[model samples]
Target: MRTAKFWMGTLLAGALALGYGCGSDANKDPTPQDVPQQQVPDAGADAGVVLTLTDAQIARVLQVANEGEVMLGQYAAPLATDQAVIDFNNQMVTEHTAVKQRLDALLAAEGITPEDSPLSLQLQAEVQQLMDVLQGPNAPAAGAALDLALLSAQLNAHARTAFIGDSLLTPQATNTALQQELASERQAVQTHINEASDLQSVIVLPPVEP
Candidate 1:
């Protein structure tokens, strides 16, 4: 069983190496390949989708999510020049780190060891795909391009985070404290989505003349 800390460390290190350790490609907009996302049922749909995830899996999902957000912020902060981007990155790092620590504490207190599930592994793969886009040949150059890349990724990530939390983790969590925490975190993810959208609007270049 890979520990959460080990998973976090491995992801962070690999993202750092991919985004910064390798020389960046300039004047190129990152176009990340489409990655598979969690499929949540629409409102008013039949309650047909059954999730068999355990509380331990829910814990892993929370841990993986917070860690991924932290890595995303940390990887992009140094490359960002815009003050708004910088501030957003800082906020992500701070908030996600705090939430992750709290989650760890809660799990420890409850003697719950996070066990990775298919959802958690898929989330990890999605993060890796995002990193590949940011670091690959078409990786954005520093400045507005980089800001756009980071903000776009953030928006999508937070949206997915909310979906998984609301549709899967929160519902599956049996612990009252864990459910409450997931609710709070989902709210935070929504805020992050709004912030990222605003930032993307600010940084995205206008359409080029034909």
Candidate 2:
């Protein structure tokens, strides 16, 4: 049962030590040595192909997911006036929190700890930018204005989450349990994206006073 502080400290230390964001290697394809074998589960034609991931990749995925959960939860805390927005925010908070907890437990069980990667660092920067926008003087004063900002941010965040869960993490996952988790993560992110889009459509911004 490693504490959250421990996990954060370890991940940040690793990120700094490795200089994760220093190079452009983040976009490089996984080398032959780095690639994990795929396992085809028997479920007929509808069964999707399952891929394998290295332990390092798994750690990276967990780190990104954990940081995302923390950032979204923080951003959602201050914008709870509208019941609809509040409900959506609550759902995201609950889902992402559970994701982080589950990933943490998996890492602990495997005697592994998460380390930071370029993607995680990128997500951190994005979260900070969004926070600054929300908290700055220019931030909207509640109502539809606030809801639009929040939903827009959530849309972008969940889009990235979906991409990472599907393109970056899912294909590289080796463990059956982890693969299942990633699948669920992808679905959840897509759901968030749809919800955010719907909210954005219905929000009626107040008109400017001439």
Candidate 3:
């Protein structure tokens, strides 16, 4: 049961990180830009793999990518004591921020404004719950326990985000630019997952009291 709880906590923390940090006004109207329209190439030709995704799915992808950055980006400051974790956190923030920008540009090009999905809301709730626990009195101390919590959460979050990028967004996205961005983001997320796992392996948690 403890193991299950720990895994669940990490999963929720990840979902929260992905869903949080999205601005409340993200769904607001986008200012018109004079961006040139790149024609979506034929799926069979130059396009490697093309999946037809609805505008809503594209927007959800944008939301997740954008919010995920915000969540991970905020970690460096709080976990700054550990140089390794800080370095990893900073890298994630940079990579995710770039991906978010790319997703925003893609949305603008497609003239599809982003909106929050039901899934996003659910993720946000889960994250909020995790945050509550972290802030509670019984929360882990500011060393291995805290590091493990953050790392574990980020690991699960990256894994989930990578799955979405690979399985859901990449396959269904028709835009060449979006596809390229997803491919790169997917690779980056995988890298983070591996790094987080490696870090987690070395963290020696304090023994639990009976």
Q: Against the hidden reference, what TM-scores do the models get?
A: 0.73, 0.65, 0.63
The order of the candidates by TM-score, greatest first, is 1, 2, 3
Better of 1 and 3 by TM-score: 1
User: For each candidate, what is the lDDT?
Assistant: 0.68, 0.56, 0.53
lDDT of 2 by residue, 1-210 (tens): 211111322222332222212223321222222111112123444234333446555666666755665576567656746677778877777777887878778777776656655445555666676666667677666766676666555655665566556555777767777777677677776666666655555554323569
The C-alpha local distance difference test score for the whole of candidate 1 amounts to: 0.68
> Which one is best on TM-score?
1
Estimate the overall C-alpha local distance difference test score of candidate 3.
0.53
10 residues in a row with least lDDT, candidate 1: 19-28
RMSD of 1: 10.2
TM-score of 3: 0.63
Candidate 2: minimum summed lDDT over ten consecutive residues — where?
32-41
Residue 51 lDDT in model 3?
36
